[model samples]
Target chain A: MIFIVLFCFISFPEQRNINELKGTISMIEHERNDIEIMLDNVGMVYDSADGKEVTALTSVTMDIHKGEFISLLGPSGCGKTTLLRIIADLIHPTSGNVLIGGVSPKDARLKRRYGMVFQSATLYDWRTVIKNIELPLEITHCPKKERHERAMKMLDLVGLSDFADHYPRQLSGGMQQRVGIARALALQPEILLMDEPFSALDEFTREKLHVDLLKIWRKTNKTIIFVTHNIQESVFLSDRICVLSPHPGRLSAIIDVDLPRPRTMDIKDTPEFTALVSKVRNSFEGV
Target chain B: MKKLKKLLTSKFFITIVWVVMLIAVWELFAFHVENIKRTPENVQPHLSGIVDSLTSDRKINGSQTALQMVIENAKATLTRAGIGYIIGIASGFLLALFMSLSKIVEKTSFPYLMLIQLIPILGMAPIINAITGDIAKSRIIIAAILTFYPVATNTLAGFKSVQREKHELMYSYAANKFQIYTKTMIPACIPYFFTGLKISAPMAITASILVDTLQGGIGLGCLLSQSLKGAMTRYVFWDIVFFSAVIGILSFYIMGIIEIMMCPYRRTGKR
Candidate 1:
């Protein structure tokens, strides 16, 4: 009887592990079927002050899957930021349609399903760090106590609890951008749209933030669309990098990054990382 | 002790020293003039004469001393200017909001507003006085007219100065027009609004006094005119001029203090 009891105890955990594996398999299958964002031949045109029509984007078709970290990688004047803005419903596409989670971008925006971080921190100087993070919640009429709790949580996530009461002017550039990230995440939106959020920072801070961002992605598991002109940065953080060409910006290639999870800064020096970066760089050539 | 030492070495202390030097030079020049002319009439009063006129209890003409009269007139002038300044700022804020909300209104009206600003307040004072009839009301009207343009322009600039990304960020949150104004635009406009007030505050006082003097009412301008009519001594006249200048400087500092208080983040330090 003692032998049988030991057998049961040992086998029980194995059964639970099998069940957990099945649950994960089902979750992955569900995610595969879920399309978080879809763009169908989206294009944008601007009427210059001199009466000339400038094509900012042309035929940018793509699909971003659920919980995916995608980067719109390109050089200057590539309309990557414009595309991000289009996804956020901040600007209207002159042609084609953008659907976020099977609904119009406008509808999704109205529902508060999207959060955006700009290249600049864009924090209000009058508000303290925590208050700036709570801005979106305040605009949506969330209860004051709940807003405070969520802002504190976001500050913790960004490792900035100590500076919660400090003003934006009091913070360094990297810290300010961290606050910006915290603010964007405060609303707990399903999709985060970042437009070159760390491009303004120095390399050291940028690398630190990249690790922090991946950790954040792992924890939150939210769909992230990052826009950047840096080749290695695109290869580093992205699950998939969409390389775009300028002079009427258009998508040229989609490269899937098959790197390991919870990637560290050491991964940046690896041969696989350099090869991926070169591939993204090569896409920009001959265009 | 350390704080006191810091204060002694500060900009405020240096300014005081310069002002004292200027007064000393002026006093010496006045003494020379008095010695050469052998009479106080038609010449600027020395520092001692001005000080005597300021502190004396004897009535200059039939009322109180020159200092008391100057104080009384300043109260009336400041009250009118204060009322006019409030009215002008409130109206200018609304007008700026209107202009910022609609580009059509701004484009149509801004040129005319500039034209009106170009026409001097003194030039319009007579016409306003004729229209209003009452001297006090006309003075207030003149002050408001002078105060409006700078406030409106500055407020408009503040509204326009908001970054495009910031506005887009607000838009992404589905913030309405009113929310955008109150939450982001208005807070951003505070510094610029104060800048406008700084320019307009002194002008409001000057306009009130000018209209009062021109239209024959009770104020520093009236005091100056009455003194010029040989009712007061040259010393008392110089005292009134100095008092008006002091009032102008005081109003500017008051606006600056209020601005700093309203937007403390503008202050930069190690932390």
Candidate 2:
């Protein structure tokens, strides 16, 4: 009986190890099959206000997998927002191409595959919170009833259904950003591009939002590309942090965050989280 | 009573008090003038005398009382000014839309528009009068010219005031140029357009009156010129001035009310 028990215990781990390797292989294969965004050596250069040529981004090649919460982590002027804008088709790349679901960025944009939240809330002052969420739907000519229903659903998702009738100016900065997130998500786009949506909020509010966002991400299963300069924020929220260097911004390193899912504020206090943050911070050297 | 107290303490009440005080001071000066010098031709009328002229049942030219004639003339002037104001606003808005769509157009036209503003209406009125050969039509044209500058400039500024990010947001939604104009540009421009209208309203009335004075016409301007020529009492002249000033003030307030109504968001900081 002791021999049998020992053999079972010994073989269990080996079998599990094989299954783990197989799982990793399949994950890679699945990721390849479901590549949501692909940037092929994208570059952007434009004339500055003083008529001098400024290179905002160079050789920014990246593959964003479906349903992955990736962050473009960089300092100011590192072209993280620029790269995100390029992917959203808000701006064109000077060189190379961006493919979303194997099609051009512009085509993907036309198909309404991307929902972007700006650094500022960008809520129309004229629109109430619920109406602001309905803007994208209204633009797409969705039925009035559906627009209202979807807007309310988004408000509920952001835990702001109570403030649906409030205008943007009536809300705090954190609440405004929550509404912005709700507005972006209301479109039910395949991908979400957030440009430092919480950078303007206080730390307490940001932490709370981080958990809320994770919950929403889990529920929605939409791929999100968050852009931020904060290292800790990147570590706390991202599945992978794409660290970028300034002075003609380029991707320096892509760090995988192997921390457990459904991350809460408690996860931020872990040694693993701090170590990951420092690794991303060190990537900024020699830029 | 509480509402009345609030009203009495309001800015409008303060303005009324100041106006009454000025009238009282003018009446005191008129009363002190030597009886010999206080003839119909030489002396400024007292406030009471001006009031009497406005209230008098005596006919000035035809069967119309002095007050009736004044109202008729005022209505004519206001109609011309009103037509001119509408034309100015519409054309100026269109010009602003055109200029905002292209930086080159703005650069080319803005300087010339500023130069046109510098050319005084007094100088332009007679020339327009000569070309049109009808003083009434020329008066309308002069009012339009006076009203156009501020509206165009203000509307252009409003259109440009939209943040670049907001524009990008619209573009991201695949909003067409027309959609951008209607949904974003027009609503953004409302407050500025109303501001311009507030400035232009009085100018329109003043321009019409000036044009009428320069080229004799059937309006308050004609009445003023006729009164100045000693055809009417000095009190009548003062009454005309008071009525015209009142019209200008009323037009300005009307624009203000429209502004408040159309943009209720501006009233509260809750936007």
> Candidate 2 residues A93-161, lDDT tens each?
999767787778898888888888887898888767888898888888899999999999999999999
| TM-scores (chain A) of the candidates | 0.87, 0.87
lDDT of 2 at A196: 91
Off by over 4 Å in 2: A1-32, A49-52, B1-37, B40-43, B269-271
Predictions' DockQ, in order = 0.39, 0.30
Evaluated at residue B7, the lDDT of candidate 2 is 94
TM-score of each: 0.91, 0.88
Model 1, A197-226: lDDT tens digits are 999999999999999999988998989999
Task: Categorize the docking of model 2.
Answer: acceptable
Q: What is the interface RMSD of each candidate, in Å?
A: 2.0, 2.1
